[model samples]
Target: MHDITHRNRAESPSSKTLFKATAIALVVGAGLLVTTVLPAEYGIDPTGVGGYLGLTQLNAIAPQETAEPVEDPMISDAQLASLLNPVWKSSAPLRNDTLTITLGPNEGAEIKAQMQEGDRFMFKWEAQGPVNFDMHGERPNAGDEFTSYWTGRNKTNANGAFQAPFEGVHGWYWHNGGAQPVTVTVTTTGFYEKLYKL
Candidate 1:
């Protein structure tokens, strides 16, 4: 009688129901992967649901031919100090100045600081509109000889530290490339003699 009871339990309907439920779950999971997961994650929409939901844009691939990476070359405050020459010293008082320059469309202007070699300063400038700029230096009497430290295009703000590499003028040349006039406001603080327009 015990053997008969065990045989009957082994043949119960619960095992068949569990098998059917597992099979249904696997089919549903596979359907979701094809209709949703593949389209949203890989931008491959075979069922068209991802495109309708705008999920394809999340992982869309951009054209490689027109993509370019921009790099910022500004140096940090600590690096500016360490780059100064050991023999060069500044006894001048720390000065702060703010100047505004207006440029018409396609016009260019330069403002410089009279600095001796090894003088360090922090400078920040912003434009009312987009402008092109070159941060550079030149000797007092050097004929057409200049050194450019950094340059940027279509930028609205620039901030960085500068250590003079020579006894000369160090500053920026700004060019307004937009259709309207743009004003650039420059602020500087450091061991400089004076700030003047060039």
Candidate 2:
């Protein structure tokens, strides 16, 4: 009976040791599998957070501006004159068809004969004399003799003629109903006398 009891105790200890070794091996293998697979799928890691899933934090980029094309304005005196009127031929006696200067009193400038969208003309007076005129409801002041003139919206002694920026309608009326006969000269071409674009 004593020998049998001793043998039973030895066998019991061996069985318990084998069971513990098997349990420890299974736990270690499961931990290795979770560490390798869980980080790639759930973005979770034992050591780091974002680096586990290969993600990085960066700043947002802004959009850039695009380049566009521009078109130039059409400039042609003959074309402008034709746009104003085709049949209104320039008088051979008058040197300039853009404007006709009448040096006598109570005489109006015959601009209606050759007025056009691009027809820019000027009426410069040799002497400042009393002149009356109307343009788009804005008439020239009385007793103001102008030296050098343009048929544009703004008037000054800068240039001798009006400049047509583009194809647009414009008009001017003048009367030399003063005491002396006014001698006015005019010149017109395809040159733009003012800066319209900035």
Specify the highest-lDDT model's number.
1
Clashing residue pairs in candidate 2 (N, C-alpha, C atoms within 3 angstroms): 129-145
Kindly report which residue stretches of model 2 are placed more than 4 angstroms away from their true locations once superposed. 1-100, 112-128, 135-171, 191-198
Q: How many residue pairs clash in each candidate at the backbone level? A: 0, 1
Off by over 4 Å in 1: 1-89
Give the worst 10-residue stretch by lDDT in candidate 2. 189-198
In order, what lDDT does every prediction score? Answer: 0.90, 0.44
Q: Write the per-residue lDDT of candidate 2 for residues 1-198, one digit (tens) a residue.
A: 366744656456587798999999999887754665445555456655435435312111234667664464665888787788855333222334334355477666633222334444554422245566443211234234422333432122123455333333233456677666764433344322221110
Tell me how candidate 2 scores on lDDT: 0.44
Pick out the ten consecutive residues of candidate 1 with the lowest summed lDDT. Answer: 63-72
Distance from true location, Cα of 99 in model 1, Å: 0.6
